[model samples]
Target: MRGIRSLNHLPKRCYAAARRSEALTVPLAGIKPSSATPLPPQNVQVSKLPNGLVVASLENYSPTASVGVFVRAGSRHETVENQGVSHVLRLAANLTSKGASAFKLCRGMEALGGSLSVTSSRETMVYTADCLRDNLGTLLEHLVNVTAAQEFRPWEVSDLTPRVKIDKALAQQCPQIGVIEKLHEAAYKNALSNSLYCPDYMVDHVSSDMLQSFVKDNFTTGRMALVGLGVDHSVLRQVAEGLLSERSGAGAPVAKALYRGGELRVQNNEALVHALIASEGGVTGSAEANAFTVLQRVLGAGPHVKRGSNITSKLSQGIAKATAQPFDATAFNASYSDSGLFGVYTISQADSAGEVIKAAIAQVSGVAEGTVSEADITRAKNQVKADYLMSLESSETLLEEIGAQVLATAAYQLPDSVLQAIDAVTQDDVVKAAKKFVDGKKTMASSGHLTNTPFVDEV
Candidate 1:
């Protein structure tokens, strides 16, 4: 007890002063927020290298920076034989690159206290590293090496087997995921229907050769973008020039996704029934899509504020009040390169699944058939814009958004422009976008206890 040290000599004011000093220490002191000055519409600088590689970067004041390379090689490019190639490639990211052992690469990242992760979507794959500004150059170099590295060792491929199996098992066990997977399948027959996850049957089929081939074919400069957040734009450009190749395949053509509305019902003993009924929504970043975005908010996702049973959307409220048993209905809108889906997902007990789905259908039909009020449209537009702006607060998400926008549209959408687009969406536009899916063959997917789940045509 005599040896025990305490800060008795330090005054309490010292702690307050330390915190105040910390708060005042800004990374970039010149950068300050001012309402009267009006911030720049788009501060992100985008440049294309001689090799046709697009480099997009956001300059800001932050201790941590997120940098990544987003490629167009995803499930859309996968063939029947290589259905899970993207998932395999995603796992292969940051593994042993040429001239760098896995240990060395991992050690290097660990030295900088960085985190590396890979995510694969329906039409893109993103490899991201979050680290300090001092580590940016090293991290960017690693991203390039990771992208172009050829060695997808058989041992690593074998290790992913259990992981792939676990992914499939987890999806099967979670009816929410199962219903969404099936909904995509039912919505689009061929191209867009490719599962984001590696399927159970295809787990054994994804090999190192297939992944390497995918990289060779799709990891091209034209099909990819190097993106950075909270990093100097000029620094990003230099890294892009030094690392990414000016040569590679332009990637396989994206298969046109034509919506074919149908029904998919999978029976599992999971007590809770999960069902999704959606119609084709809007294209990526399109006005119609933006309208649907507003409509989704207007339709309501769930309770706006937590704790209370009072839901904001008519459908949610209807489900809450109408169902004898407890249930939840959420509005969903999934977007891709060319096509989109707008629907409501409902989860309910087995005995009440049918009624819940029907109630959801009635709500959707009401939105499509009935005229929406000006106040609802105005509120939904504001909500959609707020959601988009809030998401931009994260460096990692901003990096992905920048890269994805570049890969998908070859242009950036400024936040102001997006707000203007939302502002332009009138009630008529909302109604039309809502009815677009309803007019088309409805996409119905049901999982879990199917006995109580409504059939496709029944609703």
Candidate 2:
């Protein structure tokens, strides 16, 4: 009887399975695909508040959003009395603010699945916050507190000394960083000569009063730009008008960066030599700067392929012929608001450093003498355009780009415009840029086994 019952149920099960398979192959009778229209893309909208704060935002409609407070209080703004204050202030971002305690600030950001970070360069300090779009309001409040409402308690500021030392120690581990810092120190007469790290004497000595005074002098509305991505422009404007308008006026006069060529060398027993030789190039956002940028790509800014030799680089080709040792060479171009540095950076075995450095500079000389072809210029322009476009694809980089431009020019140049500017660089313009670097006063910074490295004047 049990076998008979099982046999009877088997036919019904088979029928049900057949029906399910049929259902899997076909759509249901009444289901329909979505008919809603997609939203139109929004361009970056920029406006200024009555208090002189620049507000810029783009509605990318992304799930994640980012906002940054860009202030002109970089190392360049530091005075002789406040050297390394910016470095200490960068580490003090998470300290208790006027509106929130340090503990609450940390926990609030964590609860919202967000992050806040502070990064400074020679000319700017950016306080950036990232969070989901739904929780952007809460995260943005934290950013405001960090940038505008800081208390900088003495004990908390004192606690940042160890971190500052760690930063300097870690930077010491990288020869590239040391060389760059030395380059800046050697390149400028006054404003631009400041190092990004805290000096040894000022590491624990950057007092709370100093931080507060620095903020009071530099974090004014006129010197700040509030920028955001994947956000509503009006909301950003409201935040700027409401909370960020406290420091209304231009707080202090800015001193222009003066470029004076010199040299700084560090003698060490390391097996490798890192050398940078530069000349005054072009101011930021100028046509000359664009040419310098194109020239950088022509000489090869860096390897396009990861861990691959830049065989196509003129610097690499030139240096490879001069020495058989393993070496890396690339063009280095840094443009600031008032000045720029254009040069070649080379790293080679200590014994081959002189040959590598001379060869790298000789490549620039070749370009200055019209050795570069129209084809080279075209390829470099393409590279510049591609790099600029690719950088904007990331939300974080895009925010930074927008902030930098707005802070500098009080306006944004569209990508098409930027590409057009890059394309407008003629072969003659590149040659002229090369000639400027070849003829201008040079600043050199090198580390590791100076016995083989050439001096600035020698190069």
Highest-scoring model, TM-score: 2
Candidate 2 to truth, TM = 0.93
Clashing pairs in 1: none
Candidate 2 error regions (>4 Å): 1-31
Worst 10 residues of 2 by lDDT: 1-10
List, residue by residue over 69-94, the lDDT tens digit for candidate 2: 99999999999999999999999999
Backbone-clash count (model 2) = 0
Residue 23 displacement in candidate 2 (angstroms): 24
Error of 1 at 11 (Å): 21
Per-residue CA lDDT of model 1 for 1-459, tens digit only, reads 767657796678887676754564455567776548654544888887767688888877677888888888778788888888887777677567785878888998899899889888888888888889888877777777788765888887878888787777776767787788899888887878888788778887788888877787888887888888878888887776766664344666767887889998888788888889988888888888888898888888667676755367777777877775456788889888789999888888888888898887777677788657899999898888888899988776778778888777667888888889889999888888778867767889988878877788887
User: Which pairs clash in the backbone of model 2?
Assistant: none
* Candidate that would win on lDDT: 2
lDDT of 2 at 179: 94
TM-scores for the candidates: 0.88, 0.93
